[model samples]
Target: MAICTHHPTMKQSRTNGGRKKEDTRSNAIRQSSGISNHLFEALRALRYPDRARLLWVDRFCFNQDNTEIDLMFSIYSKATSVIIWLGKENPVTKTAFEVMDSLAYIICRERNGAGMKGDNISPFAMKERPSDCSLFLNGQDFFCFSFSRKGPKMYRLPRHGSLGDDAIFRFNDDRLWTEIDGILSNSYLERAWIVEEVAAAAEVNVFRGKSNMPWSVFWAAYLGRQIFAFKPHMASDPDASYGAI
Candidate 1:
């Protein structure tokens, strides 16, 4: 289970003698003392019943007395992965995850069906690249992916002509749009440190309520929603297909 350092409740402490006070050196005591009920619930939700999970919790790892912003950069960049905790689930949250899961499946499946390997896709690798891989393609143009950390790798996606309007019909749900809003409205997205935490990590996973998903899937669903919003124009063009996902 991971603990987020950005939670306001856990960060609050009283100053002493007209000066900023320092925290105690005992990491265990400090972590145990600072955990609020909300954080407790989040940690409980992330617990594994049968196995122990190795977590790089910022609250336990960072020294509050000597907290350095540079350490945040080094820690997240070097870690294997990052887990984003969005606290306990609510009624809407479950529906949101379900919708995102369904949408993500369709999005990835469409790419795979077009001859692209799903396993080769990485959100971190593709973050700065074009969201719509087909947007800049000509008939002879090669659609390629570049990776920096995971060795020098490239993927040339075959031109599958057009993906048609079949996938568009699947996303034409008001419920999906509502759920997308619900997912984005979570307070975890508002944290100041989240930007660095997400961007620097090699892999990122999101946990909300009882559901957990890869950052790639979440990003695909959001992109799918954007494509859905412009369905009218997208359905008209043969080349500008569902490849936008």
Candidate 2:
């Protein structure tokens, strides 16, 4: 699968432009052959235990030239999966994933067709969910997921209750939705190209630090919240808007 990344122009420097190539703005950002600071930060945070794992980031895969570029669609379509990088992790990252996971688990396991309708899970579901489902007993909150007839078991949560990042953990609705909105409002989600990239891929995975979650589950939780907006986010509410376990 292709790794789909969104380029955020926050704190960006002007690319080098010369008199010869005036029409192309490519040289401005393309002046340097090195990767962007944000990309470098993501790469450094990535924990690939082995020697080094190869990833197809746009900065490295394609030429930096801004003119006559026509490979974006083909690249996305050819990818088996898309890795959407939200940003560096924060305290809210972990809680956001866990709550989203909890909601995904309930809907998939209970087969609640009324809420989600026709399963948007086909494109975004995980192809290989972990074999072990560990449930922690203490007051800690966690999520356990099960797939339908054809899919793999999706999420196997950690003991600390963190999602993908090292964010603080909690299962409360007020705390949960508050953290979730923080993530959803990130600059990455605002990019125009993200829609085309996500739509073209078969599976979409979102990552931050050590935590990760399926894009379908995350999206569903966001939609679920909108559907059941009348009540508060606490567990007592049956709407499942905040994605409680």
Candidate 3:
């Protein structure tokens, strides 16, 4: 009789484990894509040469819960420098830059005025300290995005030379501020004053579209006490071309 050797049989691995891992990876990708939609489109418009390396973009850095430590740290790190879009759709980047530059120049001049001068001041020193100012002061170069209106809108004010109490719409509107103060605290009022002073100087009105309350009420009740107003005309049209101011 011929000697027969029994061979051991090899078992096949299960497909279920690999399938589950793949499913999990797909779900993670889907979640990440969803979060990216919430990021402000204007900030995205300014092309960052090394965006992939910069951390703080909500989509890549933040977790679904938004309370994650990594996301918080990334946001804190990049909080100082921010890109404010002029509009929600088709922002005029060049125009916005020019406006900001002009405002910077104006600030420099104002700081060097006699009132701001001190014994320690130098003739060649840069006069303006925008960081010290509490208002936007950049004129009507910014657009506020309204979630309810589903669009962005520009805030406009009268010309720079226009002066006098009547030149501003809210010069006599002390009642509005009183009502606003009732709703918001004193600390909030102080902060709003700084923003308001800047807005007033620019002659621009602030608007928050798509809120339950009317623009007047919204301004007086919330934004008004804070010294901001609502201007419906600033709404942005996505189809229009963005031009330099």
What are the per-model numbers of colliding residue pairs? 0, 9, 4
TM, every model: 0.49, 0.53, 0.28
Query: In candidate 3, what residue range of length 10 has the lowest lDDT sum?
Result: 1-10
Residue 114 lDDT, candidate 2, scale 0-100:
30
**Two-way lDDT contest, 2 vs 3, winner:** 2
Q: For candidate 2, what's the RMSD? A: 12.9
Model 2 C-alpha lDDT versus the unseen true structure: 0.48
Candidate 1 to truth, TM: 0.49
What TM-score, to 2 decimals, does candidate 2 have? 0.53
Task: Kindly report which residue stretches of model 2 are placed more than 4 angstroms away from their true locations once superposed.
Answer: 1-34, 59-69, 105-111, 115-153, 156-178, 228-245
lDDT of 3: 0.28
**Per-model CA lDDT versus the true structure:** 0.49, 0.48, 0.28
For model 3, residues 140-240, the per-residue Cα lDDT tens digits are 32222222122333322222343322332232444332322222332322442234222222122221111122122223223222222221213233343
Residues 1-245, candidate 2, lDDT per residue (tens digit)?
12543223212222222334432443344346465545544554442433443455654556536731355656666555566665566565676676566544434432342344554443333333333642222334335453322365545533344443223224234655655665554456665666776776656777765567777666655553333333344432232222110
Top-TM-score candidate index? 2
Question: What ranges in model 3 sit over 4 Å off?
Answer: 1-32, 38-52, 58-60, 63-91, 114-245
Regions of model 1 farther than 4 Å from truth: 1-32, 59-67, 105-179, 190-193, 230-245
What is the lDDT for 39 in model 1?
Answer: 50
